[model samples]
Structures are given as C-alpha cells and as structure tokens.
Target: MQSFGTSARVGYDSSAFYDRKIYAEPEEVEDGSSEENAVPELNRLYAHSSSSMHELPDNSVHLMVTSPPYNVGKDYDEDMSVEEYRRFLTEVWEETYRVLVHGGRACINVANVGRRPYLPLSAFITADMIDVGFLMRGQIIWNKQASAGSSCAWGSWRSPSNPVLRDVHEYILVFSKGDFARQKPECEQKQATIGRDNFLEWTKSVWEFAAESA
Candidate 1:
C-alpha cells in the first residue's frame, strides 16, 4: 500500500496494493493470474496520486476530472439501491474535494441513467452533486450521434411527442469542489469584450459533432 511521487518522479508497487491476500475475506482469489494483472492496472491509474491527496501536499492537483460511470444498470456490477449508490458517490466526491486545490477545478462528464422503478437519474444525480458541496456551474450539452434512439429512451422524463423535441442531447455537468466561478466568465466575457472579428451565430443546445467532419 506504499505510494511514491514528487513533481516529475512517481511510481508504485502495484503488486502489493492489489494483493488479494489482504482482502481474503472477500473470497480468496483462487485465480491468482487475474489478480496479478489487475495490480498493474491500478498503478497506471494512480501513478500520479500523492497519498490520496493528503500525502501529495496541499493544493497539489491542478485538475481533478473523471467520467463517473453512468449508472444505467448496464452491467455496472451492482444493483445496489439508488441510495447506496449515492453513498458510494458521496465518499468518492468527498475524497475528490479533499484533494482539489483551493482554486483547483473538478469536472465530471456524467450522463443521467434511468431504469424501471427509479425516476430521472440525471435530475437526482444533479441534485446530489450540489448537496455534496460541489458548486454547480452551467451544464454543457453534447448532442452526439449514436445510432438511433434506443427503445430504452433517454434519462430525462419525456414523452413520445413533446415540445422539447427528441432528446439528442446529453449532459456534461460542470461542478467545482467549492465556491468557484459559476462559469469561466473570462472565456465568455473575453469573447464578448475582446470582440470577435467574425460574425457570431447563436449556438443551440443540440450539437452535431461527427467523427469525421469537413
């Protein structure tokens, strides 16, 4: 469970950290080979982490960002009650907040998920994030093209026909660890005050980005 890092140099003993021996209670991993491979994978992800943010020195991480697993019940390996899921996320974000620098920013590219029984997943998640102390910034819409709308439908509450039209939009929620800027007004304001030499067309929520564009 030893970690090492300072500026440029960093490394870890993946084998020790992922040692199944320590977590034997969770059923001994009789298959030793799979566990061995997972060790290196762990190292690759946390190679830059400095002691769970606490050991890394204060305000060390410039950018803390991740795409949290969209819990659409698409084989996330857990069917936990939404409350439990929220708790898990609570811990994850608490740690993230602890590590983020005073001015450091955290961006979670999360999409909403909705299954039977539960209601709007994104709406609930959005509320939970704000409750967890992260300042809510404006959301970015990603109108990506991915086949046709599945019979599964999108997360937001909608109908076959609505005024909003088809939900070709996904959410890229922008949240900060603390009382951070609601939006990066500098970029927005600068674009305004600095003045654009070119014509500025109004942008819509729906974006049509393609893998291959002209």
Candidate 2:
C-alpha cells in the first residue's frame, strides 16, 4: 500500500480526483479526513497526514505489491520532470525497505513513461532501488496482448527515424528487502517449489494474465 502525508497536492475543483476541502482540517492524512478515521481503507479521505516514507518501523510488512500513480494525468500527482519523478519513487522504495520483513518481497508494476520514447523508466527505477539497498530480483512483463496504447498508431510507422512503438506491455519489478532465509522449516521446502523458484531458465518475462484496464 502507499502512504500519503500532508505534503501531497490536491486540486479543489476536481471531484473526479479530489474534494475542495481536503487537507483543510485536523486530519490523519493530507486528504482532510479526521484523525479519528485513520485506517487503511480510509486513507484517501483523511487529512493532516504525517506518514513518512523513510522512517517506518522495521519488519512490519510481509509482502507488498502496488501500482502507484504515475504522476501523469492524475490530479493528486503534480506534474514533474522524469528525473524528479524518479527521486520521489526512490523515497517510496526506501520506506518499503524499512517496513518489510527480512524475507519480504515488494513487487512494483510500472509502465514506461515518455514524451519521447527513448526514456526507459522501468529500468531506471529498478536500478535506483538496487542503489538504495533493495536487491533486484528480476522483471516480468505484463503483456496486454490485444490492448493498444495511445501512441500505437505513431509507432506503426516503420521508418527508422520515427518515434518508438506504443507500449502495449508493462513491467513488474520483483525486489527483496534483505537477505532471506525461511523462518520456519516447512517454508524452506516451499521455496524450492516451481512457483517460488525464480532461478529456472525456461521462465518467460512476458505474462498475459491481465487486461488493459489494469
């Protein structure tokens, strides 16, 4: 799950994304809901957020997988350059590392972002997380087989000097917080199972278990 403090920006006129009075009261989060309603489900409706991305208690989370807002069209995410956006994500990963148990895993699903298609956003994030103490395990592609992206038509131009193809696939990065060993004897055997074994060579990075709406 993601955490928000009073630092987020929410536009008042956009009801489709945020309300006008968010962060105006004594709230538990930046969203303006009261402190009394502080709960996981109520995170979006609260105010006065104090959650920090880097100071969480250690070993509190077992497994965390989230698709965070890309800070693109979303109103809650203010527009920023790609480099600035990367820095924000790095901070979030730092917090994830602090909160995760030794054997915990965090999966991040991020589609590449580009005004020009030359930028490889997913690769940069994976590298940045490794720089900050998280172990980069591997990458998986979430292929939306029949679905099309907005820039697909432009990409279909086979010209060498043309813009890159529209991305119909997204990447899911798998990372580990710390060096891991099973806490229980039975769990060690489970790690050797085919599903848990990430070392197998025949595994494909491309996966097709989802939809464009995801």
Candidate 3:
C-alpha cells in the first residue's frame, strides 16, 4: 500500500474551471409579489462524525455524497485491520440507508490500494452497500490525471518482468434506496433541471479532471 504525506501545502488553482456561470437566471415574477421573489433559507449542517448519525431523521435525506477513509494507514483512519475496516464501513452504510428516502441516492468516492495484493476497495464497498439494502446504480470513473512520478513503487522499473500499473482514476459508486427514481413534487421538478453543458458532460461515465495539489 502507498502512504501519503501529512504536510499541508497550497492546492491547485481550479478557479478557471469553475468561473463560468452555466445556470440561467430565474424567471421574473409577473405579479411582483414579495413571496414570489423571496429566496428560501438554506439550512446546512457542517459537522464531522465517524459513526452513527443521531442528528438526522430516518428516511429524511434525499442524497448523500461521501469519501470515507481508505484504511491505508492514513492519519485519520487509526490503522484498522481489513475486517475492522469492513465492519466500520458496514455500520456507516447501514446508518446511511436508514436515513435515506425511498428513492434517495448515495454516492461514494473510493480508490483501490496496494500493488502486491491489489486491494479493490470500491468493489468491496459495493458489496457492502448491497448487503445494507442499497440498489446499485452503476459507477462513474473519475480520471484524476495521476502523475507517474508521484508513485515510488515501479516494480522492475523498465523491465517487463513485473511492471506496476499506475492508478490514474477513482470510482464514484452510486446507489439508490428502494427505488431507482427519486420522487419529487411538480414545483421541485423545475429546480432539478441540469444546465445544458453540464448535462452533456456529466452524463458520460468517464470524467477527466486534475487531482487536488497538496
């Protein structure tokens, strides 16, 4: 398995990719009523919890996106055994399934680790999610444009005897609770529309992007 550095550094400047405004302006209110023009307050919770989520209600969440610990001796992972790691993830997923709505979606971003044994973390998580009663909705490949120079292990280096393949991408596994389609009211449907450029690009299975600098 590979180890990561703990030092903090300046991250890559990705503002160029996000500066464009793709969303169209909201329609002007014909009646000009205060309520029609009012923007709803967005209540957000930003907290960190490794285990049970007591704050959230059962079947209340519409979507969940998470990038859990990889159990690869990271500073935050506490060096858990493989079985212990699996159990920990299972518990978290069970809690996630309980809090999701009937047709809510869960997206998990994960990458494989190790070169000798080749631990497929994403596949293991997929099985665990299925065991927790989540329907698999396929996955997206996030090509993070990994640099070969970053990896220290090259096996035989230049020889074909044992060449290690560099992992340049990660998996974004998607799952739905109970049903494939999420149920929404007519009023909320308008808010769910995707931008034209985003719709075309996001629909593809492969997403090419740069990795965040440390």
> What is the lDDT of every predicted structure here?
0.51, 0.63, 0.75
TM-score between model 2 and native: 0.61
Give the TM-score (vs. native) of candidate 1.
0.52
- lDDT per residue, candidate 2, 1-214, as tens digits? 2233334664333343333466343321121211121123322432422225323345656677877668777767878787887887777787776667665688899887765445677888888877777766689988886665445555546667754566678889988765533253343455455554554543777776547453
Q: What is the TM-score of each candidate against the true structure?
A: 0.52, 0.61, 0.74
lDDT of 1: 0.51
**Candidates ranked by lDDT:** 3, 2, 1
Off by over 4 Å in 2: 1-56, 115-117, 149-151, 155-163, 185-204, 212-214
After superposition on all C-alphas, the RMSD of every candidate to the true structure, in Å, is: 19.2, 18.3, 15.7
The runs of at least 3 residues in candidate 3 whose Cα sits more than 4 Å from the true structure, single-residue gaps closed, are: 1-50, 146-154, 191-193
Which of the two, 1 or 3, has more TM-score?
3
User: lDDT per residue, candidate 1, 118-173, as tens digits?
Assistant: 35555666777666666665666766666434443454355545322344456666
- Per-residue alpha-carbon lDDT of candidate 3 for residues 1-214, written as tens digits (9 for 90 to 100): 2223424554555444445464243222121111111112237564767368776766667788999889877677778877888998999899988777677789999999997799999999999998787888899999887432465464556767777888889999999887766657556666546788999899889988777763
Could you tell me which 10 consecutive residues in candidate 1 have the lowest summed lDDT? 29-38
